[model samples]
Target: MNYEGSGHGLARFLAKARQGQGFTVGALGGSVSIGHGLKRGMRYEQSAYSELNMHRIVFDYLDKLFPAKNGRQIGGDNTKRGANRFVNGAVPAIGSDYFAMCFGHHIPEDVDLVLVDMAINDGFSEKGAESYETLLRHLLALPNRPAVINLQVFALMFQTIATGGDIHQGISSYYDVPTVSLRNLLLPIILQNSSYGISYFDHPPGTTELDREGLGTRHISAKGHGLIGRLTNAFIDMRIRDLVTGLYGAELESRLVPETPREQIRALQRFNTYEAIPAIPPKCLSAHSRSPTLIPSTNKGWFKYLIADQPGSIVSFDFVTAGGLVQLSVYRSHNAGLGTAACWVDDMKDKRVIIEARWDDLVSIGYTVTIANDLEDGDHVLTCELLEETKDPQKKHEFRIIAVIR
Candidate 1:
């Protein structure tokens, strides 16, 4: 959690907040950001079904500390339930590709502060990185240039190999955006067998030793949420205090990031600085992949794509992208019924990639996989065909495409 200068977008929020103006705080990301296992084992007498997430805690603090004199809220209702507006646009299993493709529908336009947490969900992929950059650009290009913070939440998975974090950190550094690292704050404690780290996280029954505690592969416990929330509030309070003290001088914000000497070299070598450009909201072809045309699914949303189990069934899409990245979103789950599909660009069947729909997870989620990258900035056609001929009879023989992102 580094200071992003007095020009931080959040400073505007603090200013408006001090003036008694209504403010809205919004969030977007995957399962962790939305609190998946949060209610499983409640603590401190926390409500089982309450919207008791870390962001919600932040919202509560803002509502009380900076009360709007007019009592105006984004809820637009006379009630105080949603005063000083809070929008939760997070989809549990979706990645940045899907979120950037459908940003307009999810995020509120009048939001003063936006929290984006894609640290763990965006598995290492160039498409994920591009979409994240595009999303940040859109947030920065907003009419008011509302404050956007990149909150990279980490789990025990970081102890192993890379989990799409390096790319995210590099991108954040390049943009010099206001980003926070939960991993940096907590990882060392778990590594050193510290006592506080063990208390902050929950483990299986009677699993006490830190070395034996499987790197937090599961959702963090309620107390973990509380600590993070309190810490975040503390950070915000410090910034608010600075805003009130005239510490944010007229100096311009720094454009480069990762102020270290080695990091500065990497930041300068990059040819294209993605500081310009707006969001590219994709044409969501949910259940229409088989029909070879864009159509609404019976499920009636871009969040879910449905494909029938038929051999040689094909879904085709033609798109033009200046960024030269094509992404395919599909359902990967533990279900045996999910079918496999072959994806290719520009009718080049020779370079097609075989995508297996089955995953070891217990739940079904919209997972984005890169179909093609490093293409020319021109017209391209993407083809996906279902290969249903398998020896397993109980197989679902189904493939779902959440969206086709460019």
Candidate 2:
């Protein structure tokens, strides 16, 4: 059975929709949440996966269940009041390590419902664990008090979920957030021969996009996406019955306990909203000729990762903040053609964190590591230079800087 916890968060959102009120739904995940390879009329547009993915399905269900009435006045006009908005904040090759710091830029703070699909494309490390936890803590501590769901999807070639799921599951349990695992819920259908063909559950033949990743990740077909939508809708329908009968709030309120899992998680929230953090997307410092190589790594994704190939090439950003711990989001890989990055604050060249791109792993992932821990409250220059050589030349010299966060 899927974990619904106290069902309070879901019930609250449902209660608002049942009253014809507007709400904002959001999703944070990897490719599957956005219907990456699923072709819809040979395009990647707003309507591409509008009916297939679960994020859109949740939005569609709310719209159908709560039809607009009387052309309600909203946003200084007669629209958008009873309309529910879904923010699809999923990127193709990103993991929670990227979103854990960059979510504030993508997801609205006033969102009502959040769907998390990080079962795959997740880093299997302690950093991955804390980053995933950081994301949950921040989302749960939001002012709107949205319902968060950990939607565990399956990885095709691996035939298993992310090893990071164990940590994601425990964090979800610690916060009592709703979790629905398709791997756990629909095992029988996924394992045995079903009505759906191979294409339904897999990507097209001869495509090594995910297969060559060494992790065996693949995109779900349109049919597979539809099934996910249906399964999520089933949970919503169950909550709807409770909402109609007034058991939504009453049952949860009556069963409230003093020591709550969610409340405990709230106290431990990360990246204080009140803190004077630096702005996102620090200005590029590379030359005009090199700008093209420094890719803008975003497509509904949170942040960018800049790559430096040649030695003496440096990426720098100046930011002012009431200083605390400083962290840098970068790309890490086990494959070849990666380099080391020398990261540090202004003038403190001796105190720098040398980021190694290659590690003993099978997959490349987004990672965040501390670069500077102590900086006085003032202005500072952060830099990451590509080193000419590294301890391991098997992996080439190419430094990647995802983002610098305080």
Candidate 3:
């Protein structure tokens, strides 16, 4: 398999770490990195029904190459128990932008190598690019200068490959980060190999079958995830071998250093330098009898939010800043009661932007949307007016203002 971008940084890091210099590996992404279809244990345990995801496989390989002095279990359980050096910080259905809000707290400071896999969830949004760059910049600026690898895994379809692959690749190139695209390896084989007796572009007939399991549509099956892990490990192995052999010449160290584009660096700097004003606690927001109510979030990972059942109800808040980019952290849910909201920034009199807040999942997940990116740096107000009640009669509008990232 051809490693699409460059893995110079990753190669150098692995080469050094392989010789008893143990390193901590961290992963942040969507379901693929989370081992969605695999069995879950108390720790990072893999049962008979479960297989190692890419993160786990990488950890397993690392442990093999440089065993820990006091190693515990070697599966998903190890990560949970902190017995393993790997940290899986992936949240299912999350995109690049969503990661920005909780990133400071979720990603550990001591992470030596970080693998990001969010190709499918990020889709093809311009904001995805911006947030992706932001994530990369944050990682690159870490004290340890961790090697960040962008992993792009695809479903059994061309469209999924094209969209997710392009966006991740673009970011990877801009930052000189190493990237691995599973589609790049599987596409040609899928097109040419008829002997596999499988539908290379679609899920197999039964969900229980191995081929179907291997061609997991949106969420990859256990076998599919295992294959990705194997391929990724192989790619890393090859790159490490090349580096050891001095195939990259004298410029290897320089090549490994990330050379982020100047414009992107400035954008990220602006994003980072901006002062953030916390949202008013949900308890203070007034709600009508028919409006969505403020409730304690069941998911402790997210900030508290408000939910509205009545259309036309409004959730308003104000903050002072020298206005620039103002981000709204809202809880978007696909379950019935959730509906779209028309966002008005600054003076209530002036209309800035309107966003349709909806999701496909029943559980409420926190999402960050840039409400006002170009506000004149100063005091500004934001209001999310529920436009229409959700189609689900039983469910009401769900909204939350978790944090305001300027």
Candidate 4:
């Protein structure tokens, strides 16, 4: 497999990591990174579902390349150990726009390398480009200056050599970071082998089958994921060697300037940063019929949150700073009872912004929704209320409050 994009930053980091000077690695992406559809062992607390995802494969490779000195165990079990640490920060079905709000707080400050594998989840669009660039700049600007590699894992149906692959290339070009496209690397091999009997572009082998809904959709099988992991490891090895031996220094240096210039980078850095806003708990507010109740979040690690399923349930908070942009952390689910909520800021009673509190799948997960932007600097009040109920009587429409940021 061939390595795509610049390798200067990645090479510098890998050289140190390869020599037993361990470093922490982090990943940010969606379901593919979460090992969706893979088999899991009966053990309830495995780091991943039977270790079938890309991040797991990369971690294994790192362990072998740089063996741990003390043989520290990972995930509180002796099943895995390595000098370097790994953080699988990927959340299923999330996009780059929600990265900072959802998983930013959890990422380690001393991260040395980050793998961004969100091409399929992000789709191919201009908004995807902006969000992708925003995520890249945020990682680069970190105090440690961690190296980032865009690992684009895709299926033949959702992405091809031309569509999602091209979009990722454009974004990577702007950041001067290394990128590895599974579409470009794996598709050619699959296409040449007639034994696989795959004639149509969309009907790639081991990618489509009858899922729970009896519909033919694209999902990489376990074997396919392994192939991707192997290809990525090979690409990393090649790039590291090239960079360390000074074979590609000039080409790598040329990428630092980006194709569009520095203005684009500056704009993204400014737009992505925000101050964390304090959320006022319901108990602090005056007792009212619509006040939401504080309860433990069904989505673990979120601590206690305010949740209400009844229509007209209200959660309000105040902000006393110069507000340019505000984000509301919410919970979304595909359950039939989930409904929608309306948000109002300050005296904008007539301008109620409706937010859908439903997802396409059964899993309940945290999401960040931007409620307001470009607000005047001063005191401001925000109110969120359940506006409607789902049609299903068994399921109740609910909204969860996680955090507020501006």
Instruction: Please report the candidate that would top TM-score against the real structure.
Output: 2
lDDT of 1: 0.63
Q: How many residue pairs clash in each candidate?
A: 1, 0, 20, 1
lDDT per residue for candidate 1 within 1-73, as digits (tens), equals 7434434567666766665656777777776666764655554223311356766767778878888765534
Better of 2 and 3 by TM-score: 2
Error of 4 at 193 (Å): 8.1
Task: Write down the RMSD of all candidates, one decimal each.
Answer: 6.8, 7.0, 8.0, 8.1
The residue-by-residue lDDT of candidate 3 on 197-272, one tens digit each, is 2432234455333242333455555565676778778877787778778776655644544444233443334455
Model 3, residue 321: C-alpha shift (Å): 5.3
TM-score of predicted model 1?
Answer: 0.71
lDDT (Cα atoms) of all candidates against the true structure: 0.63, 0.63, 0.58, 0.58
lDDT of 2 by residue, 237-282 (tens): 8888876677745555335322233334232346454544222322
Candidate 2, residue 209: Cα displacement in angstroms equals 17
| Model 4 CA RMSD to the hidden true structure, in angstroms | 8.1
**Cand. 4 TM to true fold:** 0.71
Sorting all predicted structures by TM-score, with the top scorer first, yields: 2, 1, 4, 3
Cα displacement (angstroms), candidate 4, residue 200, comes to 17
lDDT accuracy of residue 223 in candidate 3: 60
lDDT score for residue 197 of model 1 = 60
Report how far off residue 170 is in candidate 2 (Å): 1.7
- Clashing residue pairs in candidate 4 are 337-395
Q: List the candidates' TM-scores in order.
A: 0.71, 0.77, 0.69, 0.71
The better candidate by lDDT, 1 or 3, is 1
Tens-place lDDT per residue, model 4, 80-136, is 333577766666556665664334543565677888876765556666666666677
Ten-residue stretch with the least lDDT total in model 3: 281-290
User: After superposition, which runs of candidate 1 have C-alpha atoms over 4 Å from their true positions?
Assistant: 2-7, 41-51, 69-83, 124-127, 158-162, 194-199, 202-216, 249-269, 272-294, 297-326, 333-337, 343-354, 359-366, 369-385, 389-398
